[model samples]
Target: MFILLFSAVLAESLVEIVNSDPTSSWVAIDYPREVITLAKMRAMLGDETEVDGLETMEYVEPDGVPTSFDARQQWPGKLFAVRNQQSCGSCWAHATSEAVGDRFAIKGCSKGVLSVQDLVSCDKNDNGCNGGSGPRAMSYAQSRGITTETCLPYVSGNGRVPSCPSKCKNNSTITRYKTQNNPTFTVANVQQELMNNGPLYFRFTVYSDFMNYKSGVYQHKSGKQEGGHAVLLVGWGVENGVKYWLCQNSWGPSWGERGFFKILRGNNHCDSEKGFWAGSVKC
Candidate 1:
């Protein structure tokens, strides 16, 4: 015996939850509805132009075994997990800041875990924490430079600050080689980069159903399309002849079997046949 119920929220996101047992539960969402709702709100407030630059990158999978060449065998013992501004659309800052934090860890210094708050409040290129491109944010970091998390910490609540942090002590040990603004990167390239570098940043359209992703291989939910903002490429491997890329999510350890997801490696999803890769500087 199974039962399902559907309800809509104030945010216009339709939620469907299923009760399997006395205690077990599940949920499903109507992503398009949420997008439409957001769109309508923007239209009503004359904020349509604010979402103008947001673009959906084409999805491409990688080809072969991805490799990492960086000297750092694994991410810093103290990796900083970040929460992407989903409906708020600040993935660009989250992705860039997370990568920077990881790069700092590779420096073998104090394991600097920089704050995303700094990027969110300080960066001028993109709309604060709203959706922005990784390359663009990286370019901004290169030009103006980023401050340590110590000087400026992150604040989770909403509301904007009139002024930005003034601390300018540069303690990062990572260097950006070249950044590509392609819609997606190949898995082969990702894997190779992981073997060569340390970790990589990625963005994908997450379906609301993903919030309920428990375990096992994930397939797109039927009639569902909730695009997520940002994620991290941690590791990759072949499981029982099937290839998979281990993704580290920021939904906290309570979700998805310790906040981790395994995606079909090298599939058209976000262009990584080999695997998307990002490098870190060796200190």
Candidate 2:
């Protein structure tokens, strides 16, 4: 008993092996051992608006079953995807594009992948490839609208912020998307909104252990605090008694649960559920 207790304590002090995925889609990287740079780990969401301090609507958990509802499953090809931002911290732009892109699909608008490259290059309020807030990206979409991937492909992978383009290459064919800002809310309010609104732009803190998360409902276990990250929250579900929010990431399909993750829900675990901007995609 004493030896077992000591071993448990020792394990807590170290990054545990988390790659016990049943489906085997997780690609694990023992983060601390791998040692990713501070710059590379710094994805956007650091500039998110304070939703917890806002005038929030009261949320009452309605009657429901503990089950899964996948946005990808619902919309099929229409739903936005889990992409890669390379080593750039343009997650804010990526999340914003996917979130509103989903809204376009939900409203029966033509299916399109909104361009993060446009936001990265054009949103004068943001830091381009360095970092930016998801909310600001939404507002940028609302004001001037954003072009598609074909019009302006992502060049942030080259690791330099270019000047904002005065004109999209395929200006006439470029389908732009627009959005209106909505207040941020908790997981209590997410269930219905996700069903009705498609996907949402959300942010959360990333810990060292997150790098090892391949599968399973993620919770902050043992690891160093990394920094803030922005992602798209598409839906919610329950798995093995744990309520989780299904999130789509921009780290490509090779990361997380096939570029998606089920995070522990309801208590705002890692601040992912704390505050997320809701919006209306102008169809």
Candidate 3:
């Protein structure tokens, strides 16, 4: 009993065993929650970072936003509630849908939640739940258009990507949108876009240590490379002298900071200072 207890404690010190693989009996997390195994976790990252996103030359509404701001509290009624992506690597879908959904609200077009499952299942160019590209997902909305959450709710929570529905799952109203890249991807530009428009999309590198993140401004403390991930950056602020960018995760509200987390800002923290994109809801 003493030996077993010691082993358990040692394992936990390194990583949390959210779920165990039934057959392998491996201490690492299995499926449907958060993949703890390094390989599987890396596989979850589908963001194509090879493409050059480093560029800056555009307008900046300097007077539109304050130095420190949070869209959740400042804007209100323009954002959607936190959602759970389960074990599926559908972060791309969530980021794109949430950002575009916010545009709908900000534009006074619709207040309904956009269907992320629609993108996951239907966007054949990118893998369903396995992983996807944020920019591709945004362009999908632009060309093909997405539906309302009520129309085709998410059904990939079990880890496996579900088949695309022939039409809206239970409704008929399709919420379409079009996205354009933020050419001038700077901290100031990102903040101005968030305050003026809404959430924006970006692909950031995710390390294994991120799984254990509880709170505080997160930096790549310690852990092997997991892979690139996509998230909807909502706001930015300074906490206890730590400057951070606020982001809404698709890992459900039970995870980090009520489904949100603040990461280190400036100097392209987590590569968020690049590969940024945002769009509007096409009525």
Candidate 4:
């Protein structure tokens, strides 16, 4: 019993386990920490039930979808930079906004960064900071539209989502942009959509070990289940004989690899390879 207790404690020390494990596909390092409880982690993912209704758009598989693909490489100078969601469990908002923003940029729209705060505050369908799903946020983005990040900058990192504003913070004649033609791509054709469009939005079960991800491809070597968290699916490739999905997180650039991570791919680790949603910007 004593040995089991000690082993559990050791496993909880992310830095220790990650650094010592020879077989760990990923790496970990210590950083200034936040006391993220299980409840908060659960809130990070929000309600994803709305995603069940997504209609899978048919796509004729194109010849030669690359074995490896990265949106950043494909569309240089267009994709928005990584952003921080702060203390708010607004990954849902960030992922949807960022994915839409990327589509906008890929389509040669004038703006790149969209207002995550716009969805966090104004989208009545979602639960603000407490939690929301990618599809619901996409739905909100489609119907009502969202403004640029410059117009209504994100200030809800402190966990308090401000009231929906009637006008932009900069008051520069807000031009709202909407996403059109919601398309759902399954594992069979996900890469094709990403190659044709921009980033895709999806949610996956995040484990406690995920918080300690520093670099390399991650595969849940240890730790307990945290909760579902939404993120932007950016790319995928194989590293050291292991396949991984390169995803961007909203926790900011300080976390993971410049606010991005790679998880076990193809096998649907944490359901990462499930159907994902993306759309073109109605600029």
Candidate 5:
């Protein structure tokens, strides 16, 4: 029953991304204006409907200046990285793998990497290689368990299910602390939480143009109506006098300036109010 629902959602999301036009051609707006409009839209939409478990926090005004310090500081010494969903609809796998990796790190383990391949191939309870719920995936890990990356290294391929490695070790170190679904989580609260916690998992409506967003503030382009569903959060940092949130992207190191981007913090686009942003295990 869950598998069927997951497949349906995955199919619908893929169609949205494939059919929507790119937003890169749209005119660039000042960072402050874009942030304000997005914040307003998020507020009007409300936080309850935006995500599953978003808790309200204090609000802060958007400052166009990027902060100088690295936002990754929020999770000190934690080796957090984003996994690109690529052409596959396996965002659930990505989110699960990242959370597992972080949990392993929290246990004071040096090589704290887990294989998405293990979950992709082993978990039959949910959709394989397609979108699945983060809580469901984590629950799957808790039940059957997972292995280290050295035991089952992930092949750099997407969309297709790769063959599982022969050796299977029953090693699972992930401990889920909190999970929330707030469709209306505000940006200020999200930023505050990320600053207080280690890392956050979020879902955004991605468009084709998002694939080409190299730098600078973004605004809606034609035909760009919520196309992508991803999991990422503020890493930490400051740039150009204004405080910026370090966005850990999964597109690989070559994709966007070493596989990351910076957005103005406290702004609507990166804040919790407009979208789903939830924190997880501390390292």
Candidate 6:
């Protein structure tokens, strides 16, 4: 009990110090005070995967790439609603589903939400709620495909992944939405991928200070290493001379800027530029 209280108090003090910095590009909040232990916070973020020499999609820089771009604004209602993984380390599943769903929408396919639960329970290549890789999830989506949220639905919030179901909740036949190829995009062509495809899945190292992020361009300032997390990379922009990537997190709409946050771009802060995965949908 004493340890938990001490940790919470220490984190709160750190937030105060971060907010007090007048030159800080971001603001911190004490919203994640409920997560008393590092293990609990880590449970919300999946482990990061190594992507050295991993094959990335072939690319050529498209003309007229703008300095500022947002996938949510570019495709309006095509992006799925920001979701919450709760205490489950299923960020890999959530990010992959959002990216695939966004691509499906952009490709003039079904605009309905895809099932993260399908990936969580059925993707044998992944460990479900414990932790998974974004690239592995993408590969699973390409090979086996994923069903709609209406077919399987998500129930892993309590850190328990239910058994994979063979049929939809309503007993209707399952429709597996798939992507043509498991294409990995690099930081050099991330903007072009977003402009041509949609939101993409990427993992990053999460720090304790990042849990308190409220708004603005986030750059890790303090706190110990927590774990790795995956999020949907939506777009990019320059805020106050700092280039940042706009991302949508799965911690729900209450956290950050309506479930979206901007992080330092170009320099690969938090390893956010690594593990990029996006592909063309197969409807």
Each model's lDDT comes to: 0.47, 0.70, 0.69, 0.77, 0.47, 0.83
Candidate 6 residue 58 C-alpha distance from true site, Å? 17
lDDT of 6 by residue, 1-283 (tens): 8877887886787788789988789998877554324556678888556655554433333467898999889999899988988889999999999999888888888648999899999998899988889778988988988899988889998999888887899999888977899877787777888898899987788888888888999988888888889899999898998888899999888889999999988766777765588868765
**How close to the true structure is residue 200 of candidate 6, measured as C-alpha lDDT?**
91
Per-structure clash totals for the candidates:
50, 0, 0, 0, 40, 0
Name the runs in model 5 displaced over 4 angstroms. Answer: 1-77, 80-86, 141-145, 156-158, 162-189, 236-244, 263-283
Candidate 5: residue 88 Cα off by (Å)? 2.2
Error of 2 at 5 (Å): 30
Model 1 TM-score, 2 decimals:
0.63
For model 2, the superposed segments whose C-alpha errors exceed 4 Å read 1-39, 43-60, 64-66, 170-175
Predicted candidate 5 versus true structure: per-residue lDDT over 242-265, tens digit per residue: 444555665556544456665544
Give the per-residue lDDT of model 2 (tens digit) for 1-283: 6754653444334333444434332334433322332344554334344445544344345556336777788888878667888767788888888888778877888547778888888899888776777667777878877778877888886567777776676555555666766555555666767776788888887876676576768877655676778888877777777777789888777666778887877676776656776578766
Worst 10 residues of 3 by lDDT: 21-30
Candidate 1 lDDT: 0.47
How displaced is residue 72 in candidate 4, in Å? Answer: 1.0
Top lDDT model: 6
The TM-score-based order of candidates, best leading, equals 6, 4, 2, 3, 1, 5
- Candidates' TM-scores? 0.63, 0.81, 0.79, 0.87, 0.58, 0.92
Who wins the TM-score comparison? Answer: 6
| Residue ranges of candidate 3 with Cα displaced over 4 Å | 1-11, 14-44, 49-65, 171-184
Report the number of backbone clashes for model 1. Answer: 50
lDDT of 1 by residue, 1-283 (tens): 1112232342223233322222222233343442333332222110111222434234344455433222223644646654433233444555666665675565554336555555666667665634455555666555554555555555532434335645433443432222222223343355556554456666555554455455544444432554444566667655555556676665446556466676654454433232232434444
What would the per-residue lDDT of candidate 4 be over residues 132-187, giving only the tens digit for each residue?
A: 87667888878878898888899987789889888889666777788886666787
Between the candidate structures 4 and 6, which one is better when assessed by lDDT?
6
Better of 5 and 6 by TM-score: 6
Weakest ten-residue segment in model 4 by summed lDDT: 32-41
TM-score of 5: 0.58
